[model samples]
Target: METNNTKMFTEMFSEFENDAEEGQKQKIEEINEILDEMDEAEFYSIFTKEMFEKIDQMIEKKKLTLENAILLLKHIGYHNVIVKFFKFDFHVSSLRFRIENMITEEEKKKEGKNEKPLVDLCECNLLLSNGFISEPIISVCVTYVLKVAMSKEEGEEARKDVEMALLALSNTMYYFIEQKLYLKEIKDIVQYHQEHRNLTRLAYQSVWQFLFCRLLCDRRLEDVILNKLQFEREAIRELEELTKCIDWKKNEDKLKEMEEENLLERWIIALNIYFKEFQIRKKEHVVLIECIVQIYQASRSNYIEICNLCICLLKVILIRKNAEIEDLLKGGAVEAVLEEIQRPTLDDEMVYHILMFFVNASRRLKEEERKEMKRKVFEKLEEEGYEDTIASLFETFDFLNRKYYDELSLDISNYFVNI
Candidate 1:
């Protein structure tokens, strides 16, 4: 039985060693069938050092796709292989670099050819998604991409390289963040691109793509943002500059080039997710929190859809227990909510979101912070000459808190009664 198995493995490897594309598909199919029939333990037992050396030779000779190599490893239950590498303290960086190089070659060949350029990219993504790729492999790819992106004189080829790398990193960021590998590098890359005014649009947007992936996968990215960017004050200034840099004409040109709408809104959604996921209440986030409040204030006058989004976002943010609300109060968040709640044509649902902000803030914040927030809320309402409105809204808040039903009607009624 051992002789037969060894002979079969040797035959399979021999078939793949052929230089001709002719009969390759059939050979691959045959190989797949043979692998499928083999038990996992039996397959794993065949991964001798000689087999890896042969595979490495095939890879070096451009005789194998990284995807197929990965699939083979996966089929053989690659965990033990990784464990062995770890045990021996093998340097896997060269192997990872080879895979990265293979993917880049494939991408370049894809331009005019029908063959898929990013097959390796997709394969790496799949491996990472399945939690199979080793940490060392991930680090190689991420570090390479960051190096390309942060270079002072990146040309067109470098730009393409960085974009592909960023997209791959974006997809795999969850795993990297979870393992806490190379986080400072990612932070530095994002901060440099975000702070630099003259980077390519792709370079700037790549950071947001990275952020979006991290937000989807891990909330702790908020800690990275806070510590790395000091986001509260920086977010405000960044946003102000970002908004000011928008030229309608240039925006239209960008839309034409990218064939996508709502590019600016992507940033908004990412920020909203970060704010929603981690409820840290530090003063650092207050500038951003207040900016959201101001955005709500400005949009309410003309853009109801944006106004609704802002209110809903604020509702999510108010759930954080951190002392961040003090800045919101100082920034006039209460007044913004009050004004929006009493808007003539506002939807009851929007009002409900605004009220829920208060309810959540009351629940999530420390007692003293919540009380101070409440006091400031009322004081701001009075300052805005909405004392009577505050009384009606408070009653509505109580009714909703007590009955916990008729929330929609209560919100609507409160708005009208306040008016």
Candidate 2:
């Protein structure tokens, strides 16, 4: 018993087979219209693995051209209203079969075996950007794109392929993270770009997106990513460069440019993730602490977002027992906190985290070290006129009835006063 949806699909497939080239535009419109009219269950029933296999078979038999097939898929992909209602299984095996065939055909053409390539670069790009969303589909697309992007083939066409592959990968990267797939391959691609430095502007952005996703998804890969790539050193160097170049008070344009680059943001996020599970080493501890203090010393008016991020990272570092409080004091952590607290327009959340950094630093310390830390913190506070800052914050919290801020403020006050 053929349902109306299946019958409609059959009619459309026949039209695609019979007039693969001549009436593709009309057929595509008709197909989209049919899809738009169907309900979710009907749409799924008509567009299943078997249907994809049939399309694949048609391409194999020369009844449907690869270009037309890609066009059809693109239109279907753009059917956002219909697509949002159901999880459209992308029929990965069939798509893989078509892609493999296309690759094989290209190889044959390279060997002077075929007159016309079955699939050209434009069609390949179109197929890849078809908005396929399933895990298996994304995995296949990513694997294919990485292979092509890393291939030795040279020319404008090859470069276009690499660019297109990167665009496709960027679109699917979050899905890759959610599925937790292809960690090593993504790492290799990033490392490849790092060594080569050949990616275009857009491609470079996409690669960084991949790297950031890899950093956030897997904790076990942190050592390999950070050490092999020297990411922390690179991040510190970039931060130092920005601090030298831009006057935070008068360089809004420069800051916007840096924000667009996003290299620092990626590094900060990766470092935050890395420090969550692992203790900071002596070397990283020293450099990162110095880096934070430098940023604080330079920028009080602008870069508050980056400032807040650094403070949060410091909070994480301070929570771990292995981070020596004495090193923090020596590295000017106290001064950095005071600088941030003294900002004219401090938010409640930022204040809470700053106070909590002090709380965490003082936790589990030896009595002698605790008193020493208290002495250093209080001296810095008094030197910077922090009493007025605390008084103002207390009044704000009391007016707003922010209990969390009240509690955290009291904890830091008690910790320092008891010493």
Candidate 3:
């Protein structure tokens, strides 16, 4: 397979290199078809050191267009060749310089020819997707697109060109988030466009997609939240600004609004990350609990998912060895869970997490305190029309109960009987 693929790829390149203008469309189509059918192993088999050097030489000799070189790089550099081959950096650097020069050339060209390089450079951006291209190159592309977006062009042709550039940049945004060298500038560009130009909707969304892409791609998604710890004094201030940016009350009132904002879901995701990754410090704990409780209380009907998340966040925080469980109780966290569980729309998930919250909070207390808290919780449940739910708690399987309370789980289970 290796020898066959190598021979085929080498022959195709030989044909293209020997006659640059002969059957250009046919050759490009043939190259695309062959590349489409080639899998990772077959590709690696054919793309050798000699082929990379030859392509580099062709670019340096001006025998092949930079566009064609980019195409070749896309095919040969698949499956992390850029990362594996040190020599590929030369090709990458050359491509970067070409793209920068293209940007400069586009700036100097009149309207008629300006779109030509935009189309070509857009091709370069698409080829640079995956992991083959370096961050510096993508940063250069992003910086160029952002500059185009920022320039105050007056005519219709210029505006259309700028929009095209933004759309092109949006197409490549998934590749842009890996580099932080220009992230702040990229964000400021997006924010500026969002604030200053209603016409830049496409550009703004592309930059926003960059952030969402980073969140999806990052394995440690909570690191953003964890980094906030360093700014403890300003944490609440920052959170307040975030909270005020959206009208939560309006969101609570309308389903469409809630779905659009999805603020609670985003907040819960952050909380879950902090719950899993970091110890809940006193200040962080207080702020988180207060935030959760406030969001839960202010939330209206059909918010079981958010309610359950708040309960789970509470449960995780309560279980922490250094947790100030008293702060949660003082903030009416118990009442919030109890209220949510007794709501007519409650589901198994909500009940389960809330019950886990009780079990966890109970185990951390002294025997007398545990019994007292359990008694109060059951009384509240019964008063809130949750007597049957309380009974079901005792009848639940031991494994589920023990998972939260160990041996004390049985005692807690039995205590439900008397209530």
Of the candidates shown, which would achieve the greatest lDDT relative to the real structure?
A: 2
TM-score of every candidate relative to the true structure: 0.49, 0.56, 0.46
Tens digits of lDDT, candidate 2, 227-315? 77666665566567656755566555643444332444444555675567565565667777788777756555566666777777777
lDDT of each: 0.53, 0.59, 0.54
Q: Residue 342 lDDT in model 3?
A: 67
Preferred candidate (lDDT higher): 1 or 2: 2
- Per-residue lDDT tens digits for candidate 1, residues 314-395, read 6666665443556666766666776676675655466457766666555555767756666655565565466655554555
lDDT computed for candidate 1: 0.53
How should the candidates be ordered by TM-score, best one leading?
Answer: 2, 1, 3
Q: After superposition, how far is residue 380 of candidate 1 from its true place, in Å?
A: 11
Cα deviation at 112, candidate 1, in Å, is 19
